[model samples]
Target chain A: MATLGNSTNIFWHECPVGKLERQRLLKQKGCVVWITGLSGSGKSTLACSLNRELYTRGKLSYVLDGDNLRHGLNKDLGFKAEDRTENIRRVGEVAKLFADAGLICIASLISPYRKDRDACRAMLADENFIEVFMNMPLELCEARDSKGLYKLARAGKIKGFTGIDDPYEPPLNCEIEIQQKDGVCPTPGDMAGEVVSYLEGKGYLHYQ
Target chain B: MATLGNSTNIFWHECPVGKLERQRLLKQKGCVVWITGLSGSGKSTLACSLNRELYTRGKLSYVLDGDNLRHGLNKDLGFKAEDRTENIRRVGEVAKLFADAGLICIASLISPYRKDRDACRAMLADENFIEVFMNMPLELCEARDSKGLYKLARAGKIKGFTGIDDPYEPPLNCEIEIQQKDGVCPTPGDMAGEVVSYLEGKGYLHYQ
Candidate 1:
């Protein structure tokens, strides 16, 4: 609800260069691929794999992983519900900025709240925001527990852990959904391939 | 102070593709050009010009202008001292991420505090952070108040404005300084040329 300080005094300075211009220079359309799921849901792996795949194909992309962000950008934040919302909000803003600069911004975060993810999606154009839901069940993620987070949450050492105490509202209509079958996780390469194929099929890779 | 939430539970996910690899793909090194000065000192103009110049030369660059960011990324932030610090801090973090993505990130902000700028510099590698001080006097900037902000601040309509009530700390050992004389502002193209020359002279354009 906070408006621009003295809107009369602040005018938008139109840059000589724009998103379309940058896209032409990069030879690719800019977009935010929002990857959401529980911990150990292969979100980071898929995001990193997609980045590497894009790199091999000579495309510009970057992964804005949640853990990596906590180490720097969101270091001041905690795991409190408010902090989590702020965390996703900041990531959403950063992703929008990167996308505006004409780069594929892959955001790998356990964005538990549907409202939070929806808020992020609202920040970008419909075509620019791609929600890739890693729809692995909570039990499967807990079993993998790559970071021993599930154990900590189970032992009551960490409270409000997503999928344990907190809730993860899965996306109702995500652009891409990668679901686990029979407790089997998909390989990162295959998942990345699916995402890249989607982009290609949607004509996001071809410059107009 | 806020160590990455449960440092034991978090392991650094090193991407197979890294800064160097991205730089190689882009054919340009990543770096942050932190442009600091009083308001109306042509920071945005120089940043946009530099971005345009980089584009013409087939280099990827983006300008993170403060006013533009406030319209989106930092809209919640205000002109208070704490808010100002947070604004620069967030900008620094975003610039770092963009630089990591192998693009020249030009951050144009008032950034009146030395400690705040120093904090931003510390977030980046020594070679990757380039401090560019506009170095124009307050009187000249007031005379050229393109947005009439100086008049508002002088008339006491805007409180806590930099160069009116708050202090503007100049950089002690900036990488570049562009000064205005005889109430004349240098052409944005000329200023941008100086920045490109510095990058070229320092061998930032060549990959190691």
Candidate 2:
């Protein structure tokens, strides 16, 4: 972990309006739906579907996909270990900000490191961070190979590929897990409904 | 300027629902109100006030203040020229995301460098980035010294303080300027109203 520098001569300006007020105004509680998986595991698809579903229901939500972030906020980062950690760290921080603004932030990333995901959870309140694990088998993902990444990894064109040369640490106690059964992948709509149901069941989708 | 690394083997996943759709659903056009000024010039105050004003008017909005960001996303950054530029860069990207999510994003920071601010403007579309300059004189800010930062800078306790030792290159062609006249600063409500009026005039607050 890198040492965080202390900011001197800086003071926090207290906002007259807070997260609670914003949540009330928005008619929903702020939270982060962190979706973690390997490539071709349908993380981005599920995330985008959930975002659209929430929008249809008049709930404000946004998806922060890894690929889209790499073009903007995380463009300086690479696929190296340290850069990956920093990338996740920055995404987690940004998701925290979105949640603080009283929006449901859906973050889709191949955050293979347990410690990095745990750090993100620690950054938010317990109920605000919901970890959704996409437990698709590596073989299934390789066969799907939506982006041909697995084929390239197999051909030695890519290094540090998760679930290939690199390791993926599955979540021990994820809030929701979308798993494959009998080599059948869940539809994006079904996965999105499961997430929305989880939020609704936990009373996080609406304000009293 | 540092060159952004090209993301190899990374492809952007287009969302089924785009920014225009989100803005239409929210019944408002998305935009970023970038407020720049020296420390103690009431940038955060104005930003918060504008947020509250927008909320009361049935508009979704968020404020990205420098103080709040330092505690989270930019905690590793220090008070150096390069670090400050990076800090503003990240904030601009976040603001762009917020706007893309169909919300009015008010970003308040002491972005003293013209080039850095210009780069932020270039990240977004022409009409989406509205730069608001808090044209408060350095002497007034030093006299107010709400955070005592000016005193520290005067005593040589703080290095590279904007307007003390460092340079503050004001915006060449900002959309709006809130200048203090005769040592009398605009009231927070009045300033907030001014920003709201600007947005209304530009047909951004409500959907046509």
Question: After superposing candidate 2, which stretches have Cα over 4 Å from the reference?
Answer: A1-6, B1-6
**Per-prediction interface RMSD?**
2.9, 1.7
- Every model's TM-score: 0.95, 0.96
Fnat of candidate 2: 0.61
| DockQ for candidate 1 | 0.52
Query: Against the true structure, what is model 2's DockQ?
Result: 0.65
B99-153, model 1: which lDDT tens digit per residue? Answer: 9999999999999999999999999988899999999888888988888889989
Give the alpha-carbon lDDT of every model.
0.89, 0.89
- Native contact fraction, candidates in order: 0.46, 0.61
Docking class of 2: medium
Clashing pairs in 1: none
The most accurate candidate by TM-score is: 2
Our model 1 lands, by Cα RMSD against the true structure, at 2.2
